[model samples]
Target chain A: MTRIKSDEPTGWFMIFPALAFVGTLILYPAVNSFTLSLHRIYMGLPALGEPFVGIDNYLHLLQDPVARQAFGVTFGFVILSTILEIILGLGIALVIHEHFKGRGWVRAAVLVPWAIPTVVASQMWRFIFNDQYGLANLVLFGDQVSLYVPWLAYPGYAFLAIVFADVWKTASFAGLLILAGLQVIPEDCYDAARIDGANAWQRFWHVTLPLLKPALLTALLFRTIDAFRVFDLVFVMTQGGPGDATQVIQFYGYKTLFTEGQVGYGTSISMAVFATIFILSLFYIRTVGSSLLKRETI
Target chain B: MRYTSKQAWLLGGILLSVMGSLFPFFWFVITSIKSQVRVEAIPPTWFPDWNFSFYQTVFTDHHFLRYIGNSLMVAGSTTVVALILGVPAAYALVRVRMAGKVWILGGLLTVSMFPQIVIVGPVWQMLSTMGGLNTHWGLVLPYVGLTLPLAIWILATFFKELPTELEEAARVDGCTTVQTMLKVMAPLAAPGIFTAAILTFIYAWNEFFLALLLLTDPVKQTLPVGIALFQGEFTMPWGEIAAASVLATLPLVVIVLVFQKGIVSGLSAGAVKS
Candidate 1:
């Protein structure tokens, strides 16, 4: 807690080993990806045979229709899912903000889906959404449920299925964040609102919402960033299949690298993801990061 | 305090939401034990036949024990390595004000963010060259990279929250930095360390894509990847798959339940703060 001179060396020597691990493992691969993106590939020694062909991959990515569609889906997925999670999270957080009986159990239960492995949840929901034997149609549509609606086998429905699972799993995450926000709100404000005869809705709008902004933004940014790079559930559930309808940029990048063996091409897609996310962080930094740092410190 | 009808309705809605959330796992357990005939039946059996046979089949044929062992090894190794490496880095970053903390954090976060597919190719190539492919180390090392940055950040936050006077006093007493860290700081921050360890373990244990790509040997694969092999491209072994899944997930479920507060706190730490 001591305030020292700003110029004083904090003796950060201890961090170098950890820093080195990240630099070598993560940054090197990321930089390698960027380098690969700029190079042309030929199958040869070291596997990623290359001569530098600057910006070709980027240009090709820009022009490729499939890549474009995947980009659209990625954007759609991030924006739509993040927005929905935030809204629902805020609503649910408000409902659970106060003290109640069995609150601890309810709180733990809400996190169960979040704790489950992404692949397991995907498989579970896959069967549930199965047109033939799945419970979704049965529960939602009664015995007259048709056995032909392939949830993962179709294009649009496949996308819907991915989004449904993502939202269902993560909205509670948003809720948890907002609940933390709610917990931090001083109770006196609510007491004051009641003394002023504010209705529940009015109190929420005037009191809770304003106080919850930082946490809301934190949850939104976290969800936004996470959603942008989503790969697991989609990969396991559909493998970007049914003619790549559910394919997002991440999966597309993955396919290019691993499945096609076009290292350079895959690297280009990967770099694009890195750059896009970096840009997002910058944008988030401009708006919410400061507030987050301030609030977290307090 | 008095209850209004509106408040009561809100409580009901919240309760219903929580119940709806838990309904899937309820179904998962019920279905896992159901007979394959019942599992595939049109109407869907609401309750399982109370048969231990599915559990028997899973443990007997599927190398279920090996998968659990692999999971424990990968997850356990990941937890240990990340803590050993991350705690010092976190201390240095927060206490020493490390020069590249931001870039390091950024890079680590990026790795965490990138889909496993993006790096799996190059990583596979690299590991194969090192003869790590199909080894537990292959998965464990990547799992460390996967969890390290977040663990460092979480611990850094805890470190920052810590009052530095004790460390200062230890230093003034001629205690070395390592000694101060071990003697004064580590014990005080046990909860934070536990939080990091548990979360890292869960993440590594639950990880599928990396395990799938690197560990191609059926006998060598971890539980998640092992479970995937049971359901081939041609055939769907419903009973066996469900049973394996139930077993694969039990450790995580148990850990989450036992350390619910720590896990939740860590997740909230990540989500609500950064």
Candidate 2:
């Protein structure tokens, strides 16, 4: 191996291209977005002047009921969706973890939802919940036409629909993560549990669940961040409609920025989203990620 | 084999997993091939006459092939560039001595978690200014930046696992640093690189938010964006949308079916490593 003296330059050179790509495209734009938040620039009205508003947008965000509701909606989505995803994901992991014929097919089957585009999933669910011709109605009521529920028309049902759709789309991904954790659990633990006269329930409760924490937490971290980034589902399914019921932070930001043309205000919303996720991730890494990393090293 | 209560429970779980996972997409597949009247029937026709009029419309009218071309170009270039930049960087991170290496890796992780909306506004402005918008490279450049973290992380883990003895043996044969990396080390990490490529490709393909903003031109819009904006005014065009959805998703479904082992391992690797 080369000594440190000669190796450093080559190392720096090797990493440069990747660094350049991330730096110029992602980091630079991220910083620029923050700066844009500080000024008042309306894309539709440039003559109004892109003035430096300093903290006015932030002040306005605090008072805006819609903004508050959007944050509330996003956080609610993150909590409810991740919880369901983890529980369902655990079941999927447990089911697929066992030896069975055609297990590869099972694995691929589970990945179908994840493989489908988010927009597609949104549309699929939207159609499924359609009042006139929906699978939900067809399955539940058979030929009863009047019994159909407009799933996306009600704010509460619409929100729940979005959550259900998210869980369906991502649980397999979480299961894959939890399955990795399950794989790392030594078979000896299960063997030992059985020797102690533990039943199936006991073994899973005492052994499997305990060891799956890191993977579960990792899934939680990833899912929470992603749920906060929920836009396409809301955009495609409901357009954040039925009275702003499904307006998650990202969709709201998109509408404000692109549709409403409030550049500074819209960017300010995006900045808040970034900051919230950043802080949440920092918290996650501090609490869960460090332990997971340590376990990986060991 | 004797049927038992436990086995029955396991069988139930398995059935639920399989059916729940496949049913939605399966329904879409069904819808795609059905006649319009059959699709909107109150009871919803369970069987398709295998009418592919929707598919034909999607392919001919919606510029489905063009969307495919655009998606293929963007996703393909992103995959290649992410790897080309990522592998060497990963190798260096694993093999070469550097200052602030941990910080650099941490920064990359943070970048991976960035919300597209946050960077999207400025990125749009930047691309608009640089005349990069409405071009294939416009999407590729940002995608490469975004996917590098996953590629680099996975490749680094693979490169790290390779025994230094192999590199030393190459060195003893009077191979230069570049030569050793290109020849001895890279071949061993092929599986890892392949895994990284699949993940990156899927991501670039499925990504909607960035593609929606960056490529507004109908000729240049990627499949996700195109399919999303396919909603019609008079009718929902559920059949056509279903057809487009199925067509857009068929390639990825094929990829998953063909490469489940690599994808599972690759995704699991992200969980454990990141």
Report the number of the highest-lDDT candidate.
2
lDDT of 2 at A103: 90
Model 1, residue pairs in steric clash: A10-B96
For candidate 1, the TM-score of chain A alone versus the native chain A is: 0.90
| DockQ each | 0.49, 0.71
Over B118-232, each residue of candidate 2 has an lDDT whose tens digit, in order, gives 8899989999999999998998989999999988888887787778887888888888777788999999889899999999999999999999998889989999999889966
True contacts kept of each: 0.40, 0.80
Least accurate stretch of 10 residues (summed lDDT) in model 2 chain B? B1-10
Give the docking tier of candidate 1.
medium
Q: For model 1, how does the per-residue alpha-carbon lDDT over A144-185 read when each residue is reduced to its tens digit?
A: 645446678878888888888888888888988888788778
Candidate 2 TM-score to native: 0.96
- Considering only chain A, what is the TM-score of each predicted structure? 0.90, 0.95
Residue A222's lDDT in candidate 2:
85
